[model samples]
Target: MTESILVVEDEVRIARLLQIELECEGYRVSIAGSGHQGLELYQEQQPDLLLLDVMLPGFSGIELLRRIRAGDADTPVLLLTAKSSVEDKVSGLDLGANDYITKPFQIEELLARVRAALRLASGRKKVETDSWLRADDLELNEATREVMRAGRTIELTPREFDLLVFLLKNKRQVLNREQIMTAVWGYDYYGDTNVVDVYIRYVRKKLTQDNQEELIHTVRGIGYVLKDSL
Candidate 1:
């Protein structure tokens, strides 16, 4: 699944910068300009991660954090605060923020922390859901990250595994490249490369190894669809 992030920032330029950066990293990003809108988006979207600014127009980030933590203590929230004082950090942390970064910090550092937070969230999610996703003879174990097709174990790279999971979850549906890229790769390709096609070929090659039947079919001028014909 694609990780969604809601960024609550009153600064237009900063919000746009964050949307672009996070989307490029394959995360679905939403921007909210005030605490009210942030709260609305938070309840509606339930994003996987949140990047909240400490200062806002309607309500303070601290108050927003408090409101969110009242109902949700699980979603990872990282505060973007200009204050470097320990008290300020502690305040947000007390309100249940996973971490905070002082403003005017490097984007690289923020991105790294975002990755860490999402990983932590993903880990927690593993034990809560059924471990297996299946279609016909193919099976994917979410916990073990294992894939097996027609009694043959197939090893896949991490990205390939994510793509396969997305495909399996939406089996029998015709999925376009943009949707596939956003869901699997977590970003829009913008014609930057034929990554979707390349990865499809990679997966097909492995799935059809040893004369196994092909499960992924092309829709010609459209996109690809996964439907087991067995």
Candidate 2:
């Protein structure tokens, strides 16, 4: 099946160019000029990936991302923003954007990111013999995309959920930031590694919401490991 992409860019010329190029690449494309319409189309289409802009009329892309991640945690969202600061990018990534490209981006770069995001999303959805991933009392239902600890549910953003899944799959293996970022985020992150730390904290906070033990252990000066006991 041809993968679908929703382009939520207010810029008409850019949107047209992206749609033309993306369609040429054989993807089913949908365009929304405002954040409101973007969200509406997003619900209606449920595209495989989103090419969303940060600036949009009414609600911003960040707000749109927040709303989508509130319910759907698997769709790949690649933000299209003009903001180039690390802070700006981190803000989007924190909101669960799979990746981002600043405006004036090369078509090649943008296409590459689109492919990577879709590929990562596809890889995560592959069926496995085991439906549940667990560590002690903490468990994740891949089929349901639910996380639970000691029978209590934990709500996680898309990024946090992916991070936790990676950690759980690696169990006792110590995974460095580089390895974690590559496996979870698809492409190697060019920004600060703090993004990994930020996500780890998010997952840890949720997993231990009721004073549960932190199954993810930090190895000072190295990285982190998920284990029943450190």
Best by TM-score: 2
**How would you encode candidate 1's per-residue C-alpha lDDT over 96-157 as one tens digit per residue?**
99999898878899999999999998887776457788877888887778898887899999
Q: Estimate candidate 2's RMSD in Å.
A: 13.2
- lDDT of all the models against the reference? 0.90, 0.89
The alpha-carbon lDDT assigned to residue 22 of candidate 2 equals 100
| Model 2 regions lying over 4 Å from their true place | 83-86, 127-230
Worst 10 residues of 2 by lDDT: 122-131
For candidate 2, lDDT tens digit of each residue in 19-135? Answer: 999999999999999999999999998999999899899899989999999999889999887755666578889989999898789999999999998888887777432668999
Q: How many backbone clashes does candidate 1 have?
A: 1
